[model samples]
Target: MSQSETPSLYASRVPVFPRRVDGFFRRMKWWIMIVTLGIYYLTPWIRWDRGPDLPNQAVLLDLANRRFYFFWIEIWPHEFYFVAGLLVMAGLGLFLFTSALGRVWCGYTCPQTVWTDLFILTERWIDGDRNARVRLWKAPWSLKKARLRLTKYVVWALIGLATGGAWVFYFADAPTLLVDLVTGQAHPVAYTTMAILTFTTVFMGGIAREQVCIYACPWPRIQAAMMDEDTITIGYRDWRGEPRGKHRKAEGSDNLGDCIDCNACVNVCPMGIDIRDGQQLECITCGLCIDACDDVMAKIGKPRGLIDYFALQDEAAERAGAPPTQIWRHIFRPRTIVYTSLWSLVGVALVVALFVRPELELTVAAVRNPTYVTLSDGTVRNAYEVRLRNKHGDERPFRITLTGDPALRVTLEGTPYEAVSVPAQEMVLQRVYVTAPPGSDPAEGARTEFRFWVTDMTNGERAHQDTHFVGRGED
Candidate 1:
């Protein structure tokens, strides 16, 4: 191909200036934004009294201590299954919502969507509405434009800083960290994390905006697999609004469809796609188009729902002059039911595990380098490492004993007592020795299965770990 005929791989993005529209869905978006942002910013500050030994923060990751605390619930490092269960539940929930409502997550509660909406609101307040913004964009550089741009950028940066600041609080005590941060006494990692998050938040939510949804986010593309003919998604009723024209009183005005081709839906779309063109990948299904179209329909004395939430199945029935399928039937289909069931199952399992777990935990590992040693007295001896974990707020003594064989005796290294005191909310590692007297059944056998029982002296709570006691024949 000639140089002029060559196609460029990169195309500059056309900036989108979504006009403000007010209706049910827009109000819903405002409420959702307030609630989600409120939760994210305020959760780390909530206090929960977890005694003197543990953190009092209601929600904390406690990365340094390898623990996660949420109000009354505490998850230790070894109990990572709880975190995994929560992640699985999140995934299932996304699938469930996508299968039922089609990208509602992206349209409303997603961090990108919420933050972008906030940035847009800030922009609109500073630079005026859609027409004004367009004029400003086309005009050359000036003092007034520069001032407005600088002010908008400063506000966006502050918002980004707050977002990053709130995130770091999740991993540490919010009040203490805030003081340290202000005083420049916080850790370097904390500062580094905050800086990175701030930059990303500003770039993605403010500058990138709808481009992030189109190019960065995978959800818009992946949502197709989750949705089916029964899924209710934002769409235009081309059958009702076809043969669109601006002239309402032309020669064939009676034959013209209800659509006035005013471009109201396109103007209000955050993703900058014409919904009347049919289902496009760029559409976030934010329902702003529905609001815009409904307003126009009301003004023109036409029925509403020119652009609305509907399923493919509903389209066929509506075109055939029949009532559309009920909304409940679309949401309660098989795919969504399975996703909801899995999500609930994981949630229930996590809750059950949290309640049933023992406050005292025990783990035993046999020393393998020299598994079995034959003493001068011809007795079989096995060395093992025992870890005792005390989840309680107070320190407690734990008594260790051998459960399977009466002939086997257990002793703690460097101490003569069978019971050891473990610190509160801590794990203590103790070297243990198991011995079988000469000519005992365990001493002569190749291996004897045994259990190490650790009993809490204070509350009588017991935890046990099963292992094999290697004998002389194993060598």
Candidate 2:
């Protein structure tokens, strides 16, 4: 092929200026944005009384201490499975919603959509709505353009900084961290994390905008597999809208649908794709186009629903002059039932595990260096490192015992058996020694198994670990 015949590899981005529209769906988006942003920014500041010995931040990931606190629940490092289970349930929940409602998460709850909506609102306020913004983009740089651009970018940067700053509060005490940050005494990691998050939030929310949803987010591509014919999504009724022309019905044009070809749907779309083109991955199913078209239809005296929430099967039925399917039937189908059941089961299991899990844990590791020694008294001796955890809010006493060998006795660092005092919600590490009388363990060179048990003295709850007692060989 000649040089001119080959297409260029790069495609320049086309800017999308979504015109402002008001109706039910637009109001819903506004409420969702306010509620979600409130939760994200305010949750770290809420206080919980976890007693004087524990951190009071309601939602905290205490990484240095390897503990997670969420209101009344505290998760130690050993209980990470609870976190994993919650994540699994979250994924299943996404599947359930997508299978039933179609792109609802992307439309209403996605961080990208929420932040992009926020950035666009700021842009519209500063630079003027759709037509003015488009004109400004096409116009060459000037003092007015420079001023608007500068102001808009500064505001976006501030929002990004706030988003990043709010995130760090989840890892530390919010009040203390705020003071340290203002005084420039916070840890370097805090600054580094905030910087990285700020950069991403600004780029993804303000500059990238819809490009992140179109090219970066995998949900739009993956959602197709989850949606079926019965799944409801925002759609253009081409059967009732096509054969497009301007005021075709007023002109008494034959075989023409109700559509006036005014382009209101395309004008209000954030993704810059025509919804009439049908089921593109770029569409977030935001339903802004529905709001826009509905207003236009109401003014033009045509029955509403030129664009509306419609299942794929309902489209065919409507095209064939049949009534559309009921919305509830669309929601409670077999696929959605299965997904909902799986999600609910995972949530229930996590709740049960949280209630029934033991409050104390014990671990024992046999010392491997030289394995065992034969005392001068002809007894077999083995060493171990014992760790005990007290999960309660107050300090507790525990007694350690040895079992599995009648002739075996346990001691702590050569002292007689005594109760180990473990600090509240803390672990105690100590050295332990186990000795067995001569001929009690096994024949020379053999190993005998035993148990190290720690019983909480207050409640009599016990946690035990299995270990082996090693004996020396004799020639």
Candidate 3:
């Protein structure tokens, strides 16, 4: 092929300037953006009175201490099952939403979508609407363009920084961290994380926008598996709006469909694709196109719903002059019901586990180097390392005891008593010696299985760990 005739391997990106539109879905988007952003930025500042010893932040991931605090609930490192269960519930919830309403999460609640919408709003405020943005794009570089561009970029950067700042606050005491960050006294990791998140938020939400949803995200491809014919998704009714024409009073206009080919739907689409071309991966099902088309239909004196949330199963029935299926039937079907049940099951299980867990925990490991030591006093001694965990907010005395043989005696290495005081929200290790009287049956036996129990003196909560108590074997 000639050099000129050879097609270019790459196609440059076409910037999309979505036109501003006002309707039911538009208002819904506005409200959702406000609620989600408000929750994200303000949650870290909500103080929970979790005693003076514990963190005061309502929602915090105390990585250094290996604890997760959410309001009244505190999760220890060993209780990671709660986090795993929550992740499972999140997956199930996503599946349920996708099965019921295709890409609803992507459209409204996805962080990418929400931030992109915010950026677009900022851009619209700084630079006029769609047509003005298009004109500015095409016009030669000027001081006016530079001023608008610089202003928009500055605003986007500030929003990105705030997003990053809010995320870091979840990992520490918000007020303390904020002060440290401002004074340059915070850890380097904190600054590094915030910088990375800031860059990504600006690049993905402000610059990449639709490209992130169409390419960077895996959900759009995976969504096909979750969706079915019954899934309600935004779609164009080509059956009713075909043979599109603009002229209404012309001779051939009588045969024309409701669509005037005005491209209002396409103009308002953030993804910048024609919805009338049928379902595409780029479509987020945001319903902005629906709002745009409905407005156009109302103005043209035609019935609405040229573009609307539709189920593929209803296409044949509607084409044959039957009324569309009820939305409830599509949403409450077996697939979505199963997903909802699983999600709720996981959530309930996590709550039960969180409430019923013991406040005191014990773990014991036998020191096996010499197995059993023959003490100078003619006693068989088995040493063990025991860890006592106190989950309460205040220090509590824990009474240690063993269950196996009545002849066996337990003693902590440094202390003469069987009780040790564990600090609040801390685990303490101590050397424990289990001894049997020299002439007892347990002293001569090769091994005796026993459980070490730690009882909290304050609340009587108990935890136990099982281990083997070695003895002198018979020759």
Candidate 4:
């Protein structure tokens, strides 16, 4: 293909040896690493008071119980839409952020990038910096290189194992599971999960690295569509840096461009791209290049920011005689506003729903096969399958009150009030019979509303359901 048809910065299939950097971006990356990794390692150990019968873990996905507990909210299987809604909101929020800032998530919050950087840091610390690592890789295998590589791999393996072990703790009681795991008594599923997570962690963090961001991930493709010229991204000031020339020992050349032809920016880039060329699909907009270039500029006695996070629109305006305009509008555009409003509404609705959720529910189904039976005593009796759900964590005694009319009398064939005790988190089916007063008919072939009021005796929690009372006619 022609150069015009091709992209500016072509993707690389080779591995990169990103040199260690010490600057603002590096420190930001360090803090992100610490906070994120700390959360991952420590959250499983945090305890929550979830009554006596339930697990005390602060966050747990109780798959066996079909329940999800996070701090205080207890989600039932039917409430999966809460999770779905949150995911939708998260996706929209990501879109909004990407529209405003290019690939910032990949730089800061992406788990793959974070973990890979952590692993790389560990490798660099244990073995050596980029140059030393490259030398070790090039040299024939020796005892020193062997020992260093062996130690690094062993540590990497342990880190991967720890990552896997922490994940399954969210499914079970962490302390108990830890003991069980050590004693080799954990369930088969726990072992299975740990193994799978370990494989993924080692493969992704230790091996795949930037390939995940470039080839495996779909985010860059999505972001390409979402981003605009006003989006602030890491860019090289080509106007200032063009006509790059070699730096002299005394820095005496007036014609030399400000860049000084130093590859410091390229060395610090985790994705291994030269920013001086232009904006690129491979750039994560990490600002590390800016930091690197700034340090280089300081050494060369030039003002910093030869490379920077810039908006294309502002650059273009500055390139022309026109005054530069404010460059960011993606964060608060119509799409973002709509996404925020809907996301907030869903969050508020879920919270309210959780608060007002009932402890029990009632369901009534009229016997449709033979709808009603007329006894010889001139009383019309209706049969219904009443199902009561005790959604609480303890056995509940529910009083079923029937409401229709004053003349309407209720007589259960064997039980009174249709009252039945249901076990905790269980449902019970009962055959209920309703009969009107003697010689009194609601109406021929008509259905009257029958209401069932379920009140939990223990907590005074109440639930109600209304259904039709089938009679010979309208009742």
Candidate 5:
């Protein structure tokens, strides 16, 4: 291909080397990363005394048993609505934060940001800070560069492996699974899951970095809709930063802004975009630029907040020679209020449902192979598969009874009229037969509605399922 005919789609990738900066936001980010990573890696090892019958891991999704155990709460498969409710609350919380804080979750707590920050920290520790890294990138292949690059990649792979390993612990008994994994006796699914997560972590954090935020993640696009003028975002004070110069007292620059054009903010930005260019969708609002600019402002004997959390509305006010709005006013806006209320209501409702739900459950399925059968005495027998679930923590007996038809007689196939004993936190499927005595015949082509009631003998708790009984033509 000719030089003029180069494909427009073939764009080269550029590397970002963010310099280290120290300030309030930097310190906060350090603490948040520490806490979040600690929780992610260590939570599965934390033990809660869930008794001998249940797994002691504080938070576990026991797929084998179809149960979710979280600290003191144990959720059955039938109670999946609780998990769904939590997801809804998470979405609402994101909306609430975005409405008031402007992509704060993406900046501080998102997994992509957190892992990428960790990866960058590793790169800086092995290679050097921004200037050194830039030099290394431009330098030709050498033994020193090769050694440093190898060491950095090894450390990154280790971090990714640890991240993937930690995630698998949440699905099983952590200590046993760890032993199995180390001894090469774990399930293939476990190994496969770890491999996939490790690849994603390394690829996304080490290789992709800001590309995931810019071209991959949907939150950046959706956040624009969530943000309004009152949203607090990391913004440059352009009203005071315009007419930029290297020195405030340059020739014919008496009216220059306080900005010295040090490029510190740009050098420290992970997204490789200037905040002075105004708000861009690529920016994660990580606030590193704020720290860099604040440090510069401090060194130059100027007041801080040259690049700070400032609302766009306040930008207009500041340009009009008025003070910016208060932080509390910016926080308590209408959208945030609505989102908070919705999140809180869902949480409360889930809590209530969890506490009020029955400890026993019943489901009945009538056999349709032949629909109905006639016995020697001309009685109609309807066979059904009844499932009884014991949600209590101990094995218990439940009395099975039928209602909606006084003439219907119920009998368990194996143990005829005996109470069914269900193991703790388990379900039992039993074959049952409901027979209508000969003289109790109903009209032809009629279906009789009945209820299968299961009452826990230990606690007197009860649950019922309504089903229909098929019958032959009327006598």
Candidate 6:
């Protein structure tokens, strides 16, 4: 290949060794990490008193029973559409928030960031701070270095194990499972799940780290299109940081900009990209770089925020010696407003449907195999396979009534209405026989509608189904 045909540059993955810093942003990140991780690991263990027969865990996905319990909401298989509606609402919500603020979820709320930060903390505790860890990594194979690395791995393993153990409690009674787990009597499936989660957490959080965010997660690509110049993002103020230089004993230099050329931002970036170069796809916007630079600026007696969260368009405007423009697009712009309204409408409709759902449901398809039969008593007879359902926990008789005309009569073949009851989550196959007198027919085959109505004696709830009553041709 000719020289011109060669690619401009080779792309490679670089490792980030982010340093810890203290500032308002760092404090906020700590608070967010603690609160979010606390909720995630502890929520399944929180108990709610939902009668003796129901599970006490506040949130559970009882796959064995085909039920989902979330606080006060209990979802059955019949309510699956509600879950779909909620998912749609969540998607629209993500879009609306992304349009308002660029990648806030990626920076702060992402699980990868949360767990990685935690793993890094454990690393710091065992090995010391950023500089010490770098020195240790650079040193030869010494016993001290080996001991520090060993301690860090042990801590990482423990955190991963705890993370995995917390996840399985949502599937069963948390307290009982914990006892069973400690006694080594827990189900094989439970231990297998814990093992898998442990491996993933350690590998992704301790080892892979930001690679998961930059290369593995697809959100960054999708968000690239969602962002515009008007979206507020963590950006370096080029106007403030450019023309950077080192400081000397001299009072000031004309060419010297606000940046002191300390490389603090680069040293502390989790993704190892220089913010001064440009905003790259690998930036997670974790804001640790902001904390690092701000602390450096404070030590040098310079004002903070040489880099910051600002609209890039605004930075450009200020760079051109123009008045600062309000660069943030209003959240109520047409597209965002429409999306918000649609999301709210979907949520409202789902809530209404959940609250107003019938306690009992009846579905019927009249048997088609022998549509009708002639009775020995000279009346037309129709045999139907009917299934009875009772959603209530306590069983009771169902008063079945057939309503059509005065001459129409119905029977349960060999049973009475008082004997027909379906237990909770149970379906009873019933053979029903319907009869019509000769006077109840037209000259030819007549189309008459009959309703099978059932009233629950336990709750007074009623359910009904209407179908055709076929009559034979007679003159």
* Alpha-carbon TM-score of each model against the true structure: 0.96, 0.95, 0.98, 0.88, 0.94, 0.89
Please give the TM-score that candidate 1 achieves against the real structure. 0.96
Residue 45 accuracy (lDDT) in model 2: 99
Q: Which order, best to worst by lDDT?
A: 1, 3, 2, 5, 6, 4
Candidate 6 lDDT over residue span 41-128, tens digit each: 9999889876546788999988888888898887887779988998999888878877767787878888998899899888888887
Candidate 1: segments with Cα more than 4 A from true spot: 1-4
By TM-score rank, best first, the candidates go 3, 1, 2, 5, 6, 4
- lDDT to native, each model: 0.93, 0.91, 0.92, 0.79, 0.89, 0.79
**Candidate 3 per-residue lDDT over residues 358-402, each given as its tens digit:** 888888888988788888988999899999888888889999999
RMSD of each: 1.7, 2.1, 1.4, 4.2, 2.3, 3.2
In candidate 6, the residue pairs with backbone N, CA or C atoms under 3 Å apart (3 or more residues apart, or in different chains) clash, namely none
**In candidate 1, what are the lDDT values of residues 192-244, reduced to their tens digit?**
99999999999999999998989888988899999999999988888898889
Q: In every candidate, how many clashes are there?
A: 0, 0, 0, 7, 1, 0
lDDT of 2 by residue, 152-181 (tens): 999998999999999999999999999999
Model 5 ranges off by over 4 Å: 1-9, 441-445, 470-475
Better of 3 and 5 by lDDT: 3
Better of 2 and 5 by lDDT: 2
Location of the lowest summed lDDT over 10 successive residues in candidate 3: 466-475
Q: Best lDDT goes to which candidate?
A: 1
How good is model 3 by TM-score? Answer: 0.98
Error of 3 at 116 (Å): 0.4
Query: Residue-wise lDDT of candidate 4 within 246-346, one digit each (tens)?
Result: 85555556665787777988887888899877877788887788888888888878888678776788788766766655543535667656767877887
